[model samples]
Target: MRTLIRGMLEFLRMTVLLLFFMGIIGQLENSVVKMIIGREGYDGFRFGGNFMFLIGDLLLFMVFYRNYLQFRGWYTEEAERLPKRVTRMMLGFGFACILLPITIALIL
Candidate 1:
C-alpha cells in the first residue's frame, strides 16, 4: 500500500540521517583527540574538521525535526486508519537510533 511504502521511505531517510550524524560526530571526536595528542602542530586542520562536524550536526538536527513534524502531520491526517505495524516500525527505528550508536561507540 502507499502508506507502507511511504513509511519505508521515511525510515530509510531517517536512518541515513542518523548515519550521517554519527559519522560526523565520530570524525570530529577523532580529529580532536588526535590534535590533543599532537599538541598545537595541526591547529588549522583542527578547525576545518570541527567546523564540518558542526555543520553536519546542525543539518542533522534540522532534518530530524522536520521528519518529526512530518510524521506528526501524517499521523494526524490518518489517525483513524493508521496501521499498527507502522507504529511498531517507528518505535523500532527510534530504539535503534538510540541504541545502535551507543553500542558502536562502546565497541569501537
Candidate 2:
C-alpha cells in the first residue's frame, strides 16, 4: 500500500518535471524564441503550438499539484529505492530545470 502510494507520488513528480521542460520548449519554440529574434506577430505554427502548450501546461499543472504538496514533505521517500543511474539522470534533469531560466535570460 505504501509502495503504491509512493509510486503515485513519484509519477506526480516526474509528470511535473516533464511539464516544466515541455513548457520551456513550448514557450521558447512556439513564441518566445521568435520574440527574442524580433519576429513580429503569430503565424499558424505558433498559434497551434501555443494553443497546445497552453492546454497541456494547464492539465499537467493540475495533475502534478500533488507532487508540489509532497515536495513540502507531506510524502515519504523512505521506501524510495531508485537505481543509481536513474537517480543520476533525474538529478541531472533537475539541474537543467534549475539552470534553464538563467540560461534563457542570458541568451536573450
Q: Which candidate is the best by TM-score?
A: 1
Task: Give the worst 10-residue stretch by lDDT in candidate 1.
Answer: 38-47
| Deviation from native of the Cα of residue 90 in model 1, angstroms | 19
Runs of candidate 2 exceeding 4 Å displacement: 31-42, 46-108
What tens digits encode model 1's per-residue C-alpha lDDT throughout 36-97? Answer: 45433224342244445445455445445454545554323442432556555554555454
Q: List the residue pairs that clash in candidate 1.
A: none
lDDT of 2: 0.51
TM-score of each prediction: 0.38, 0.34
lDDT for 29 (candidate 1): 53
Report the C-alpha lDDT of model 2 over 9-83, residue by residue, as the tens digit: 777876676667676756655465355545533343322434544554444443334334435542566534455
